[model samples]
Target: MSFTSDQAVEALRAAGEPTRLRVLTLLAGDELSVMELSRILDQSQPRVSRHLKLMADAGLIERFPDGARVFYRLSSDLAARRLVDMVLDLLEDGAADQDHVRLEEVRREREAEAAAYFEQVAPRWDQMRSLYVCESAVEAAIERAAGPGPFDRVVDLGTGSGRMLTLLGKKARLCIGLDLSQNMLNIARSNTAKAGLDKVELRHGDIFATRLPGQSADLVIVHQVLHYLIDPAAAVREAARLVAPGGRLLIVDFAPHALEQLREEHQHRRLGFSDAEIAGWLREAGLATSAPIALPPDTEDLTVTIWTATRAETAKRSVA
Candidate 1:
């Protein structure tokens, strides 16, 4: 879509400032909180927030509110994203060298923090899984729910330990797993390597905004990751964005339950999702959803629910 003159001018004005430009450069790579941007830019939170607000108002960036935290990223507007790309392309070589250096430091700190948390939980991840339904049953259900596909590309969002990739990698020419924790990625890598899946790729990524292009995958799986997110619906929308035309999105998570202990013990943000909630989010994303398949636990544990949706082949809307 062509931008109006006023819109173009607004977008340009928003991108004209040096600090805002640095914000754009950093956000172009990953989603970041206002605090993180402030730390990276060596500016106060108020100052960073002001720039973010202006850019957001001008449609140059998108703000995602996740509970108490809000993350900022380049807008999904094609025109605005193209504008950002053009502006970034015009930067002098090494002009933001220090910014990049600081960004790396920030990333390392994030990695260390995430690594520590995961390290504490990694040994028990599988043990925790056993508390639910049988593993074989869940895997079979997932395989059947996803349908038979020799998909060209497959992406697993929040791919903890790369279990889904290992389970479904044979059906795809290429499979990629994305995780926020480097420790989890390491485990996933080791597991995928053990499975001898040569086409699998693992990347450190944010669930809110990933580095992959829109509608780039034939099959997208978000397995057992929603309960931990502050905004489960937003995560679903982001997962839907990765589905190609006629592609499928498979989400496996827990149904609503009174699992108060899970939150305190496991760091779960939300207890579980309801059927209506999942369906509503899928409809909002312009995907056709199938009836959810429920796998009730044999023991006294949380019930597992699998929701599948398909992106319409003729839809013109971007999955923003």
Candidate 2:
């Protein structure tokens, strides 16, 4: 048999059991000692050890000696990690019952606190560029769709840091940014001005119900914003509605996952969308769409997915 087949059989056999899968999810984000795993799963140390040993042998987790004790974590194998992430994504949000709800609440509180801290220090946003990786692949996708041009109008939804607009400044004759927070908008305005791009305008708006003109923009870019919305499908529909004939809509966000803890803590609207979900949203919005191109591995914890949609030629006449 081929190595691929052999590996597949082994992986399936190893992950087929519920206990091992649980072990993987527990160790997805951080490491845990055997005792910690036992506590989290409410299982005996011997049972947890048995599961961990199987996963480690299957190359799903690694061991580290800490004095006389050992810690276990999700393995370094990218493929194995990807498998664990996919499986976890399939699990339901309430899988952990009340514990899940409480954890999500705590996560939301922490994220709000962090967002508030960023808001208070909004003036220092420009200096915080080093803290994040500039999503180059998304930038490349937007440039490909919109091209270098003196676009008459442009809309950047969820324009965090106003980075997408700044990236489009070379071509957008008039760029408008819509976001929820006054503080984020303030930072966006300052950043645009500092870049000497006076044609850009910032507004406090929700992507779901913004009053912006429909079918006006030559390019609509929503980068790193959909995952945070409560109704990503609605947000995508709104984004598509903003695209004029011959216009392009660009979306960048995570692929779907079962990580309820991250969703609850981070205020993520959804774990993320898979390629199928992205295609469905674009088609429903009356735009011809493309599959997502995966972002580079080094981007961030969130995977980057790009979908480029162009208004159908007949779409011009179908408008109300």
Candidate 3:
């Protein structure tokens, strides 16, 4: 059954229950047979099956027939996926002692798998660029924040395929691309080199806790990246941490909407953020914030927002 926004909320409320969350944590990797889940979760198969059935009916999961057994996996519903990701992220900081270790191990395994998958797929970055057509928003935000100039230090967080670096190549004295997947970084590095951006640096790292020195960048841009983060606020804080005084931070991502299907495929953290939330985050990071500018109607399902904020002069003075 297709789930709407309201249904997505209800589904999340249902799955967000304590026990049900434990079950999902175990099932995140792949479809788990009922018995396998029961063994892992230490619950009876009947009880586990009941919760799975409810999630399935809620469009949070799907059961596929494989011979005589049915395998349950995450659903393709966007809302369901977002709900799941948000719940998982929220639980990350305060999860139970036992589950925290398990979650960490699972996350490491998942990251490794995702990295490997991206590496294998890196060569196709150029072909995949056209999949998202509205790159103008990203470009506009960057230009508005940092005027055409030769910046000595710049960073593009989550620089998928390094497209933005290519755009800003001539203008940046040193452009660095940071992302989590080696494959994406490899593609980005290759693309940067291909575009003759020999000074561009590609680093595989998490946006939330990158190795880049504090207050290191003259400009930082996180384009179409925040939505994929499990904790966007943390990532924003990190971006703010890295910007030098008088430097700018630009973020372009989807705005909050009712699309629930994005979660399963896109792994979006939140549908998007409200203007107030985005502004508050920038302000907390000591940045002078502005109202989010909404993008043109491209797809009926998703809306995008771009924010440009600058570090406060006081911030620089205090750091100095």
Candidate 4:
């Protein structure tokens, strides 16, 4: 997998520009669309897109298509990542201050939007969970699908009410729950404290770019989170990056359905996901996936689907 002289030169040339370097630094934080990049850079869409396309071609970044929109992030390739790291290290102090400031502004705007949504829904979040299926049944299925564990570390991405941590944290030496909503994190904190789970830590975080080290968790859970994301597959890829060798990723979400009302009423970006879609994402993320288990609803409710995948015992790679 060594890069040839020509490939190395091409990569350097691709990353040599100031704008492209700024783009790399921005993408180092989170995946962003062309529009977002343009806004942050105060550049035209076509200009931003050309930079992205060149970097992608040079393997300096990765592009993921979500419907009509495409998101870009730092390349997952090891050599490309190393090159990015070297470039970042060479940046002058305060060189990226402006970009960082604008990034924070964008983040605040996103936080405000999410806070408003969660404020409206926080009181009824758990109640809505009940409307889908029997809580006990779903919890049991999650436990069985996640399997028995004496894991070293566990992380729950988009932990809404801290239910998964309260249920599964006991088996792990340490458990961390991440959420973007301050209200949700507050509820999670209160719930975890009530459950007497002192090892559980809740943090306000972006799921696509958590502070945790790559391949650091023995068990990673993303319960009922995918439907809300603009790019669920990219989120899955992020979660997979956290799985240590021999670690497992357990995802609990709704099976494919035609719940159009959920989009308008609940801010659901997608109705549900098919098994094939979930499996394809897992496989693409370099995990060995199991056949998805479906828990049918008793009435006219959404069917819950559980998928579990394990990182290879000997595999060790970082995801960007």
Q: List the residue pairs that clash in candidate 4.
A: none
Clashing pairs in 1: none
Candidate 4 per-residue C-alpha lDDT over 99-156 given as tens digits, one digit per residue, 9 for 90 to 100: 8898788757755665578767776788887876778998999988878888899999
User: Which of 1 and 4 is ahead in lDDT?
Assistant: 4
Worst 10 residues of 4 by lDDT: 64-73
Clashing pairs in 3: 77-261, 78-260, 78-261, 78-262, 79-260, 79-261
- Give model 3's TM-score versus the native structure: 0.65
Ranking of models by lDDT: 4, 1, 3, 2
Q: Tens digits of per-residue lDDT for model 2 on 1-320?
A: 12266675676678778777766765664455686567667789999888888878877678855334566877656777777777789888756454334434544554466466546656665455323345555567667766667788889987767877788875888999998767889878887887889898898887877788778888898877776553467788899988888888888776654556654454543566778768977997889986567765453455567788888655654333
lDDT of 1: 0.84
Error of 2 at 265 (Å): 4.6
Tens digit of lDDT per residue, candidate 3, span 12-89?
777877778877765564445575566656679899888988888877787754334455777756667777777777
Report the number of clashing residue pairs per model. Answer: 0, 3, 6, 0
Lowest-sum lDDT 10-residue window in model 1? 110-119
Tens-digit per-residue lDDT, 47-73, candidate 1: 999999999999999986634556787
- Per-model TM-score, in order, reads 0.64, 0.59, 0.65, 0.67
The list of candidate 1 runs beyond 4 A from truth reads 1-116, 317-320
Question: In candidate 2, which residue pairs get closer than 3 Å at backbone N, Cα or C atoms, i.e. clash?
Answer: 89-257, 89-258, 107-265
RMSD values for the candidates in order, in angstroms, are: 8.0, 10.6, 10.0, 6.5
